[model samples]
Each structure stands twice: as C-alpha cells, then as structure tokens.
Target: MSSTPTDARLMDGSGLARRLVEETAARAADLTRRTGTPPCLATVLVGEDPASVTYVRMKRARCEKAGIRSRHVELPATTTTAEVVATLEGLSNDPEVHGILLQHPVGPGIDERAAFEAIAPEKDVDGVTFSSFATMSFGLPGFVSCTPGGIMRLLDAYGVDPAGKRAVVVGRSAILGKPAGMMLLARNATVTYCHSHTADLSAAVREADILVAAVGRPRFIKGEDIKPGAVVVDAGYNPGNVGDVDFDTAVTRAGLITPVPGGVGPMTIAVLLAQTVDAAERQLA
Candidate 1:
C-alpha cells in the first residue's frame, strides 16, 4: 500500500560501523585498564585459501585497532576433522583465550559442525555453537552470529523497528540467513524464510516490509521484485563486491537500501570485534 517518495536513501553502514568500533575500542581499553589483560581473541584458520587468509589478516588488524589482542592458529589443508576439533578444544580450555573464531568453510573434507561444537559456549564469540543459536533465537543474553547481530544493529541505527513489519529473509545458511530471521522474529516481525527452493519468490519478496537478502549470489534479488518503501538489507558479498539485491534497480523502489561494500560488510567485523570484547570481559569478570 505504501510507495517510495524518492530514490532510496543509502544506509550508512560503514559510518555506523566506524562509530561502533570506536565504542568497542573504548570498552577494550577499559577492560585492559581494569584487568591488565587486553581482551584476547583467538582466530583459527584451516588451509590458506587466499580469501580466508586475507580475512583473518583483516580481523587481526581490526582487533589490534580496537585495543584487543589477537592470537592465530593456522592448520594445514590436509588436517583431519579430528585434528581441527582437538585444536578448537584446546583453545576452549585455554584460560587466556576469551573469544574463539574458527574461519568458515574450513575446507572440503573437515567436519565444520564438529569443529564448531568443540568451542565452549562461553567462548563462542563467533556465535557458531548450538547454544549461541538457542540463546539468539530466544532473545537471551549470549553471543550472536556476527553478521546477523550486525544486521540488527544496522536496523537499530536506522531507526527501522521490526515490531510489526513483514520480514522476508532470502537464504537459510546456518550462520547468516537462519539467525537473521530468528532475530527479526524475536523483534516481533512476521517472518518468512525463502531459499533456493521457494516457489513464487518474487511474490514473497514483494510482500516484504523488510527484506534481508543473504543468498551469496550476485544480484539474485532483482530490482523489480523489491517492494516500494520497504527497507532492504543486502547481506550478500559475492565476487566483485556485489550483493544479493541489485542496487541499481532496488534503490529506486526502496525507502532505505544497503549498498554492498559499505553496508553489511563493515558491520560484520564491527560486531565481531564488539562480541570479542564482550566475551573477554565476561571471562575476565
């Protein structure tokens, strides 16, 4: 029933994320002052997928910038799932390590779920464990999946309350899509989850007052399908820095839309660093 009055306003995710990181930095400094131990985050990477290496490097850099400490463990591509689990379990038992992040898609053969479960729920700063999901789903106090947590923060920053909106999440990945829908639902949005198999995807998309596209495909959510005046969040980051929602077309129809590079991407790291600090403080306390 509603329509956009003009071209969609771009959501300033990078700006918001910068502010968030600054706040987290302050908290990190406080923790350091109080405990003589700077918040430490342990990042585990399997193999040297060029992309994963770059990501870990970036994360370490961010942790340093935020006044948090970083420890990295690199495992070979040939390492078995059992080895990965043992490594994670070791980190979990280490008192000095407050937060643990196991880089995703560990490799072709490793059992990612088993590796994730090896992390103690208290140190699950990456929010990969089942305990994290259960807590996130119920709006309880616990760590959240970073990307989804960032999405909620973005929504809050933009003053887009989800209390009565119709939210459609177009993906079902365990870390991103599923958690995102649960987040919106917890905020009282009427939530629908659509994936690669959804029938009449366009119809479902058009009905959304809030649209979250996390399908990791480049421009999969077309402009024509966007509902006018709807708030659009494109969480996809495929090659070429493209998002699931087509910015070119969707911008004209949406009231608010997130650009691929400066939008959800920056927020993801911001939330991760913030959560790392959170875990550290809790453990230190």
Candidate 2:
C-alpha cells in the first residue's frame, strides 16, 4: 500500500526574525534619540562552550547593528553558582543595564537553574526567572522565553490561530517546552503537556492539531506520529542543527513545519533584542 502524501506548509522563522530585528533596530534608534541612552543588554557567560560563545557573539553583533549597547561578562569555567548569582545580582542592581541574559549550560559542576534564578525578574529578558515563568504561564504581560516567543510570532505570521485547537508540547523544560505550552494555552489552545514520562507519546502527538517538538532528542518524534494537517514547531538545536521532528517525514504529515537552524534559533535572538529594548523602555518609564 502506498503512504499518504504529505501536505505540509513551511514556517520560515529566519525571515520573520530578520524583519523583527529590523523593527527592533528602528525602535532602539528612536529610543536613543529620545532618551539619549540606547538600550543595553548585559550578557553573562559562565563557561567557554564554543557554541555558547558563538551564540553570544551573534547576539552582541546584532545588538551593535540595532544601535544597542552590550556589556559582556565572561566568567571562567570554574565559576560557582554563588559567584554567578552574585554577578547577576550586581547587574540587576545596575540602572544602566536594562537586560540580563545568563547563557545556559554553564559547566558540569554548575547549577544552571540556580544561576538562572539569580537574574532579577525585571532584567530577565531571556525569561528564565521564576517570575517570568509565572507571568508567562498566567498569560500576563512579561518578557517571554525567546524561542517560545519566536514560535508564537511565527504562528501569528502564518495565520494559525490557536484558539480552540488541540496543541501538544512534547517537552517540559523551563526555558522551552514548558513555556511553549503556556504560550499556546494563552492563545486559547487546549494544550497537552507531554514529556519523557508520557506513556503513549505517539498517541498524544497524533491527537495534536498543533504539535511542538522540543524534546531535544534529534528525530525523536517520527513523522508517522504527527497528525495530518497539524502545525509543527521544531525548536530543537541538536548537533548538526537538526530538529527533534524528522523534517523530511514530518513535513509530509504536518500542515506547517519549521525548519531546524533557520527556524526557532534565529527567532530566539531576535526576541531577546526586542525584549532588551522593551526592558529599557520600562526602566525609563
């Protein structure tokens, strides 16, 4: 028997992200002209993960182009959670620092969660703070997790309304999976949260009208499990920049699917910059 042909649409996050950055740049320039102080993002890196360094550099470069200033604080690999927290606390108290982004995966001995919590909710532009998480879950006004924010932006761009739709988020991490689920719920989606503990992963996925693959395991979600016509957001950044969903197969079943590397990754930074400017505006207000 022949397989059912795929009829999926592609969501282009990179293109949208580029547009967002352009808009953010304009906002930053306007703010600078009015307030005489450009928005500033303080980037805190605990270790020297080559990938993490590259991401931070990309963010800084983008900020420069946007007319925003960046204050970088790179700590040694041996920095402890206490030290990291102290540094974040200092940045939080600095009026000039409008936003703070503590890069993830500090080191083997470091407690990433504890370090993330050190950021004050007001300056937590990356949306890693407990306060940020609470606000996001409640659908209140607050900075959002970058990747999830980007996902929502893409959904809005594609005219995919989540209201009354069955959305399944396939991960539960604080930064990505959990926040993505909350964002969907806020948009009126009937969201089902699934993770490693889920007994029937495929069943859950198949029931989704909108499926988000953020489980990190590359190709963990099979195309056969995806419901036909479902919107798929693959937010995985695995080695080789592959997504959790098997794009080749999932695209066939999904109504709209995001491509790895070009999808959520670029959007993350765009949202970060936008949020940084927002934070600065809020500070002045």
* lDDT top scorer: 1
- The sequence of per-residue lDDT tens digits that candidate 2 reaches over residues 1-285 is 124356566788889999999999999999999999999999999778999999899999999998889999999998888999899999999999999999887888888888888888889999998899998888788899998999999999999999999999999998999999998988899999999999989999999999888888998999999888889899887997688988878878788888886888889999999999999999977
- Per-candidate TM-scores read 0.97, 0.96
Q: Which residue runs of candidate 2 sit more than 4 Å off their true CA positions?
A: 1-6
Q: Write the per-residue lDDT of candidate 1 for residues 1-285, one digit (tens) a residue.
A: 124446688888999999999999999999999999999999999999999999999999999999999999999999999999999999999999999999998988999999999999999998999999999998899999999999999999889999999999999999999999999999999999999999999999999999999988899999899998999999999998889988888888899998878999999999999999999888899
**Given candidate 2, what's the lDDT at residue 160?**
96
In the order shown, the candidates' Cα RMSDs to the true structure are 2.8, 2.6
Q: Any idea what lDDT model 2 has?
A: 0.90
Q: In candidate 1, which residue pairs clash?
A: none
> Top model by TM-score, which number?
1
